[model samples]
Target: MDVLADINEYLNPTTARWYANRGIPYRRGYLFYGPPGTGKTSLTFALAGVFGLDIHVVSLLEPTLTEEELGMLFTNLPARCIVLLEDIDTAGLIRVEAPEETTESDDKRDFNVGDLTKAFKKAKKLDEALIRPGRVDHQVPFSHASQTQIKELFERMYTDDLPTTKIVIAPDSQSDVLTPPMTPISVEFEKNGHGGEESELEDIARRFSKKVPENMFSPAEIQGFLLKRKTEPRKALEEVGEWVRGMEQVFKTA
Candidate 1:
């Protein structure tokens, strides 16, 4: 959130004038590179959404694209927008001291995904020319989700729709059989829905968070597991341990 706040400040109307007054280019760039499924593309889109900018994604590695077309694409871009040049490290591009592209467009966010997941080799793998001092303004590394993030992810999934379990009684026996919530009852389901209990959800989320090691899984991975047990908060809390173990084994073997 601080990053977003800082970006907001930087994008203020006065900030561009400050840069221009100091004889600096009036553009900023961000590097959102990390392991797979760690929300690289997601965060880029979120940034664009927050700033109300359209994304102009260019893949330098696209087989059919040539240098001429790349220049043409940049030349035709809207004056105000988010330019996403993803994974420049993997594009086999070496830094050339060509004159930087200039535009009279208003303030915009530039994203360059570097794919720097390998521990400290980030500097070695990524060329200096691609992300020079003034080219990239910030390097935001998206690592695996922490414990708190994991817990929040779990709670967010069940924040809406009231929770209600049903019981069915057998014809001959008095014993009650429990059934998963029937949320597909069209009109009934809509009526039953309420913003779920926050306190109960927090408790369940804490329990679920405790079952797994911190920073071991990406946010996307944990969200994927939670989606499988969607609409069943109790089930998710109870089964997280087994799911974590299964995931661990898969990771070990991989």
Candidate 2:
């Protein structure tokens, strides 16, 4: 199963149609949100495989990226490429005050109204440009692909059989619209042999102040979850269901 095929099958057909037609200049906005173990970022790259587009990944967590810096980056992206900005929930939403702060927890607090407003303005401006029609269109939201989406994602990645048609045009209207494929790259996991890929690494680094130890979760967990469900997407949904149920229980108790 190729990631693109799974994407074609599981992703909203409207997106595929948009991609195939090259209808807009705006990029498709994908929101991949989930707990630590889920493979949100991996799917971005997998789609890269299918569309033959390069991926330009950015972290909202970068220490030096000002709101303007972010806006400029989004504005200047290559005509066709995947621009990933993970941890939307926390980017400018949380901040640690300077050491001179007097009160407890001031050192670590969810951003206040002023900061959030600024960040929101920046994000809104960025999204406005990025999600516009034609520049870059086709959004694929990656989460813990409920048994179904997970199956779809994996099938896209590992499945051997899928329906595909390669249309070769000599630089026509749509040819300029399509993004080029990402170059071959490999990640070297740690010497311990307990490692994860670049997406996992990006997620862990972005989400928390510290690195996520390998055993707790990895991008592969999504695949493992799918396999454990015997590749039955509905059955695989049980994994997502269990987690949701557990959260429900904890909230109920609290």
Candidate 3:
């Protein structure tokens, strides 16, 4: 299914009203998990752009991110915003066994893994409470990307260009002048396979896809390779074998 399209359809005004009529929270939470560098962040940004929503990124593992601070942040968030919690698995926020008995001073002075886990769980609970429908419209958890998805992402990144153009109209002296454009702009994709320029891009995309191995590397790894060999698609193809070997060696060692 087209995830973005489905999300856009679900975010309509009527959907919100339906949730309200049923006494349900008009919020949604989505979890996207896969390998690292699989375009979770990119997808979140795309969703925000498509829906004209703002994004707020938070790291649960931050040293200063106490429960009170988290509450304040959530309470002050504007309506219709996307909250992204990155590297949630590494955030150490999952519930765990409580620590052994310790004095107040000892607790303040030092915390073991169990103690830290307990604190994080408390903060996570607070986050959960505030991430309901009315305030936070969506909560997205990013995960690894599948091989097919990664290939498609690489194709889109190499072949497609998402550009924004703004046209401003000056105010008339006799009539009421609108300073800013109020209407949302719609972007339509026009396929021009026959066009020379488009054909060249398609060729490049095909060659690039041929060089990329399915499910062997993450999006980030591919991006790094592309950045190094920006104008040399053939070179990237030639060296990808060695690159994959090196990655495998590193993984084996790890």
Candidate 4:
């Protein structure tokens, strides 16, 4: 379950072929935005392992990113590299949010969506000298991926099937179904409070593929609740719901 090894397999020959065949100065962008600890950074390292490339990990959350530094970072990608910009929504050098629009009392600054778009556009148009076309890529617009997907990815990377473990109590060489070491529950249903759809999993899958969920509980958070509430699925679900409500309140207040 080496994350790097698993990523190598996931990369596959086709991916290498894609990397090899793309024209010089070609670039691919990935946006891996999500709540922390959902493996966003891990995925980048894994990809670097798979592609036999170097990983340039940058945190936009850092206070020191100036325009010149950003330009230099982009300009120095090795021929085959993965340049990771974490928390891109907070990229300070982009100047995407204007503070002048908000009064001190208002406590809400204007997000310069146009500036962000322009920064992205600039990144895309830059030549190899700025960033080798095929080498520099971005992972952005990150929303929390579905709980199921995150679990799968973790399982894939970790090679541990914790997600599929059965919940049972073991004693006297016999286990009781009502009590157990672990339980599996779908966060999708817990959060949405919906039952299985009459539509096929395929149909649901296709629809979701076309439009992924935003602001859903990530696998890590879901696992945290589950682990904390071990044998109480209902209580765990309630806690998750409450957490979401609290976050909503905080956001509203902000």
Q: Identify the candidate with maximal TM-score.
A: 1
lDDT string for model 1 (107-136, tens) is 121112222353323333567766777887
The TM-score, computed over Cα atoms with residue i paired to residue i, of candidate 4 is: 0.40
TM-scores of the models, in the order given: 0.73, 0.36, 0.61, 0.40
Better of 1 and 4 by lDDT: 1
175 in model 1: Cα distance from truth in Å?
Answer: 41
- Candidate 2 regions off by >4 Å? 1-25, 93-254
Off by over 4 Å in 1: 93-124, 161-196
- Candidate 3 is scored at a TM of 0.61
In angstroms, what RMSD does candidate 4 have relative to the true structure? 10.6
| Ranked by lDDT, top first | 1, 3, 4, 2
How many angstroms is residue 69 displaced in model 3 relative to the true structure, after the best TM-score fit? 1.4
Please list all clashing residue pairs in model 1, or write none if there are none.
162-194
- Which ten residues in a row are the worst by lDDT in model 4? 108-117
Candidate that beats the other on lDDT, 2 or 3, i.e. the better one: 3
CA displacement after TM-score superposition, residue 58 of candidate 2 (Å): 0.7
Top model number, lDDT? 1
Cα RMSD, each candidate: 12.8, 16.9, 12.8, 10.6
Better candidate by TM-score, 2 or 4: 4
Candidates' C-alpha lDDT: 0.71, 0.46, 0.58, 0.48
| lDDT, model 2 | 0.46
Q: Give Cα distance to truth, residue 16, candidate 3, Å.
A: 1.8
